[model samples]
Target chain A: MYSTTYHRPATVDEAVALFAKGSDAKYLAGGHTLLPVMKQRLAAPSDVIDIARIPTLIGIEASSETLTIKAATTYFDILSSADVKRTIPAIAHLTSVLGDPAVRYRGTIGGSVATNDPTADYPAAVLALNATVKTNRREIPADAFFQGLFTTALENDEIITAIAFPIPEKAGYAKMRNPASRFALTAVFVAKLKSGEIRVTATGASQDGVMRVPVIEQALAANWSAAALEGITISEEGLMADIHGTSDYRANLIKVMAQRAVAAAG
Target chain B: MANVQLTVNGKAVSADVEDRTLLVQLLRDHLGLTGTHVGCDTSQCGACIVHIDGRAVKSCTTLVGQVDGANITTIEGISKGDELHPMQAAFRDNHGLQCGYCTPGMIMSAIDIVNRYGADLDEDTVRHELEGNICRCTGYHNIVKSVLDAASRMKLSIAAE
Candidate 1:
């Protein structure tokens, strides 16, 4: 384990100020990923900022049609919270199945989305829901925020403040999780927008992390049915290949999981 | 070092720990409250489960400073004098544990689950909720049974009182 200074700031401004002071500092939301890397000496930062105490990044707020999830709110919190389960409950349902009990209790929405781990479940949901990722500086559309593998649009000294997802008319998220780590092997998020539009996004299937499926979205827009994917072949281009699954398997999984998600949504 | 005080098992304990000190380390090293174990340094194992302000959290991942004034409850805090906590009694009666490495954390999480969602948890719900705590033994048959039984007993006891 590497020795490092730890800082816990009460406010987002205070946390961002420290990040500005030490540009190489890492923000600790769940330590679900960062701490393990730290102990393994894979990531050695001069300072570790524990932002769990940052009041600005905690709590869940729901207006009539929009559900705002504070960045650092734990997954289990979303899963168990009655208000969250009642409004935009797909978020709560998504949390209930993510990772494991320990990881869900520790992992934060902002941290997961910001990390852009290709195998993560949140990005697909964020993208499908057309959510807004609020940062210390500005609000970023989920489509633009996720750039590529282990990369995001978030800049140094920028802390994700909250994420706001508009409540959809009907929505569901489904995933085939990696058994050992429980990360999404390939997950699909399908939502029926109130305006009669349909969106579908796939995670853990592409090498570029999460990408919107225009074909599936188009098919669903025309006919939101499980049978829509019967003849369409999802492109396997630029997908990850690993011992867990091949690129072709993930490509096939995108169609299968998408069908499953659409079926569940219906 | 930060001077922090929190109530554990109904007694307030204060300590001076570095800002980086985890609650598990503070409880085990400083306070000698060994019931809260640290099974895996990775937050994978829920061996360090404890209740902070009535919600269950894995102590291994929580900073000591974070719970400074929160009403904290450990496994040691569960017993009411000579009588065991209902979950503990249920675990013992149902053979919910083997090697007993994960008992405290399991009990903590199980209690929280029952308190938050009631003991009406089905087998699948129990399994899903237990993703945080790992048990190599029992396949969770008796562990889940223990929590369900404890929920019934606690409800009856509360009703009787």
Candidate 2:
């Protein structure tokens, strides 16, 4: 990692002020992604604002209608949160399988959502659950937040404060993980909202980042059964192709994982 | 440079380090705590796993400035004087390691597993949780046994206390 200035701001306002001062400043949450990128000399920000210490950005709050998670909240915290387990166990389960024990300890939800890695676990949950990403400036719906692979709608110096997830009636996440990195080769998150809306989102398999599978969503909305997706086939047009799996393979995984996710949710 | 003051293995230490200095670099190069090894350094290998504020984290990926006021515990801190931690003893008894390069990280992660799951941990659970720490030597059979043994021993010790 190159030489840089680190600022630990006590509050969100201070953090924003510190960030605005530097020409090239990045908000440091868990540093799982940012630090590794820096060490590889892929990025060289002049200043790093450590938002992990900001008290306002470090908790999980559950209300009657929604679950609000601070941006800096770690995966371990989510896994251990009684509120999360009680209200949205699918999210807790997703957090459990994300990365590993150590990575979950330090990797933050904010960093994961902000980075929007194509294979990341949280984006699928965010999209399927219809969560709202609250930033310092404005709130972006999950549908609008993710722009593309490793990209988000976040602007320069914009900081994510928290994400509000509507508690679905039932939800489940099924992932086929890469043996080495543990990143999802193909993962699907299915949610049946209290309003009887069924949303299906797939991650890691999409070239455009986490995306909604309209066909599966439409089928599940009608029947809410794995067999409902029997004849529906996912086109390989926009799926990611890499060493782990081909676009054709991922297209098949989308259907398979969706079935598994539905079964798990039931 | 950033002024970082942290408690390591019950000892409070302060240092001025570059903002980009990794926690593993601070421990190994500055504080002379070489127990934390850097294997992959890409956060894939858990060789640099250590406890910061009672949580296991990859030290290689964490910046020194990020843990300024936190409490850290490395492999060296697990033993009590001359006595090995139950996890360490279990590794020896079960022959959990061979080359010993990944031993420190394995032990650290094992202790954490036991701390979270307690004595009733199952073999499958131990295997699943050991994903962060990779052991090329033992093929994980002995390592899994070692963690189970350590969890049982640790539980018994806790009961006695």
| The candidate that achieves the highest DockQ relative to the unseen native structure | 2
List lDDT for all candidates, in order: 0.83, 0.92
lDDT of 2 by residue, A79-154 (tens): 9999999999999989989999999988899989999999999999999999999999999999899999888999
- Best of the candidates, TM-score: 2
Clashing pairs in 1: A101-B131, A101-B132, A102-B132
Write one digit per residue (lDDT tens) for candidate 1, span B1-161: 67888898888888877766778888888888999998877777788889888877878777666677889899999999899989999999999999999999999999888886675777787877777788867448999889889988888777889
Please tell me how candidate 2 rates in CAPRI terms: high
- Candidate 1, residues A17-127: lDDT per residue as tens digits? 887787479898987777667766788787788887577798999887888989999887878778787876667767877877656667898888888888888888888
- How do the predictions measure up, each by TM-score? 0.90, 0.98
Which ranges in model 2 have alpha carbons more than 4 Å from their true place? Answer: none
Question: Ten consecutive residues with minimal summed lDDT in candidate 2 chain B?
Answer: B130-139
